[model samples]
Target: MFRHKGKGRRYSHNLKLASILSGVAGLVNITGVLSVNSLTTNVTGHFAFFSEQLFLKNYEMALIYLLYILFFLSGAFISGLIIEWTTKYKPHSSYIIPLSIEIIIILFVGFSPDLIPGISQMIISSALLFAMGLQNALVTRVSQSVVRTTHLTGLFTDLGIELSLLFFHHQKARRKQINKSIFLKLMIILCFFLGGILGAFTYQHFQLKTLLIPVGLLLFALWYDRLLIRYYHIKRKLR
Candidate 1:
């Protein structure tokens, strides 16, 4: 139900949606990290780090990190499976489905106070990971591979290198190239950090129930996408 590009007046709308999505990703990462001691974003790095730790005699820390990595991978695998299974019926999938599922899991954890210690955290982390994967994939697809909402490490690194090139190298073409990359990279970093701050505060004060904001954002994304689709159809008909 989403379009990669919007027409004329709606161009700005797409950018706004991307920003909101990035913010949601940030919030999820922050919440997951604080509550679960795991990262929902950038599981690949987590995997590599955990692997190294495992080899270095830090078994406890490695196990915990490994769990996070596995859960995140599980999430991505689930998303991929869903897409593969539905490809025949639906050519494209909306991120709202997985996001809704993630919210449901969060609510369940929030309401059931007893579910925290044992296997509940693992399950919740898995759900969060899956939601993040779905979100990242959706944005990548919708933006035609131009945007990523989760895991700002690479984004920050890219931004740094781009800025360095912009200042150090006097090549005008290279400067223009680096500036655009830096802008989007910075945007992702800021959105994630802002989301993280909000998430940390919410979780600290409210506990596991702080996912209402992200749920609301998902609903809004669905509604906004529908509205834009309808607007496009109407305009096309008029022409």
Candidate 2:
């Protein structure tokens, strides 16, 4: 999934990509909410809060919400910048730096040292949002905008549109493609829900440490892809 891009990418690649990353996003989403009483995976709600605070003349609180949006945007900017710069020399591994950064952020927050309660919560929420921004950017670039794992708003909207199209578009080939797209969206939604469920259950016992589960999934994806590459190389040599 990380190795393919542009036209070289296939539906199966996106299927695998969406499946894993969406689940990770879901896990992070719930963990952030439970840990900080805030949403960390997306900034839509933050925008609303920012507006409300501004209207109430609570400038300090508004600024805090503004900072949350900026941090998430900054994370996305950094992820895209790294991918663009690294791709020139390391096309296949361009995603590693951003993905690694995300992993580090999650791991750090998971075992973060004690601090003032309010300050700690703020830091944790910002860090996870940043990590998620990194992840969302990486996946978007890797899939050429074909897959987005961080938020469901767009997915549900697209799914609804596409589902409607199925009734009007009658060509078999086109319908087949639409069906594939539908299935991909559904899988992402399903995995994200399941991930949230798993995170909620595990958090009761492990709390922040539950993040390690998604971290493990990411590590496995990296290792498994490398193994596949090696096996392909060996098979080509034998052929």
Candidate 3:
């Protein structure tokens, strides 16, 4: 689900990845908030705080928010860097590698609550946000920028436009397009919501261990894609 460039699977690889990642993202976001008392999946809140702090001339707090935003950007940058660096050495491993890194980051976050329980909230939030940034970039590159997972800003906006078309536009040809768009957005939103619920309930009981839930989802996707690719290659060779 993290590789290839086509209408993969039944609907499309982009939709598949978008659905899975969006769910994982929603899980991380809600659990991160409960753990760190902050949102880590997107920079929207941080941007507002940054601007507010800057306007108030609170350089210290403003700088903190600035760094937080930069950390998210750094995650995206690092994801692209890892992809490019590995591309030449391992052509087929581009997308998988960054996801591996995300898995590692989540693992760290998961363990932090226990192993390093005293870690600062900001530090934890930064790490979670960084993972989200990496995910957003990886999905964009792998999905050819067709979807994003970290936040629903663009998804909701597009969803609204598609909703209007699905309701107002009666052309059969265009209706299919509207239907597809609507399905994709709704799938993401629903998966995200379901993941959020799982995250909330699990975090309530399992605490930091809840992160492993999303990690498991990511690993399953990575492994499934690899297995599918390998199976295809084997079949081709046999033929």
Question: Against the true structure, whose TM-score is highest?
Answer: 2
Model 3: residues with Cα > 4 Å off, grouped in runs: 6-10, 167-169
Residue 182 deviation, candidate 2, in Å? 0.5
Report the lDDT tens digits of candidate 1 across residue range 1-239.
34444333243444565578888888878877788776776787678878899899999878877777666667666655654565557643445465566667556655555655454666667677767777776566556566778877667677777777766877787776677667666677787788888888899788666777777777887787778778978999999
The residue ranges of model 1 lying beyond 4 angstroms of the native Cα positions read: 5-14, 52-64, 84-89, 92-96, 112-119, 168-178
CA RMSD per model (angstroms):
3.9, 1.4, 1.8
Model 2 Cα shift for residue 148 (angstroms): 0.3
Pull out the clashing pairs in model 3: none
> What does candidate 3's lDDT look like per residue over 1-239, in tens digits?
66675554335776788789999999999998888778888999999999999999999989988888998999999999998788789767788778988999899989985778688888888888899999999888777787788898888998888787777889998898889878888888888889999999998788988999999999999888889889999999999
In model 2, where do residues sit more than 4 Å from their true spots?
A: 113-119
- Candidate 2 lDDT tens digits, 1-239: 89877788889999999999999999999999898888988999999999999999999989989989988998899999999999999998898899889999998888874333335677898999999999999999899888999999999999999999998999999999999999999999999999999999999999898899999988888887788779878999999
What local distance difference test score does each model get?
Answer: 0.69, 0.91, 0.86
How does residue 1 of candidate 1 score in lDDT? 34
Greater TM-score among 1 and 3 belongs to 3
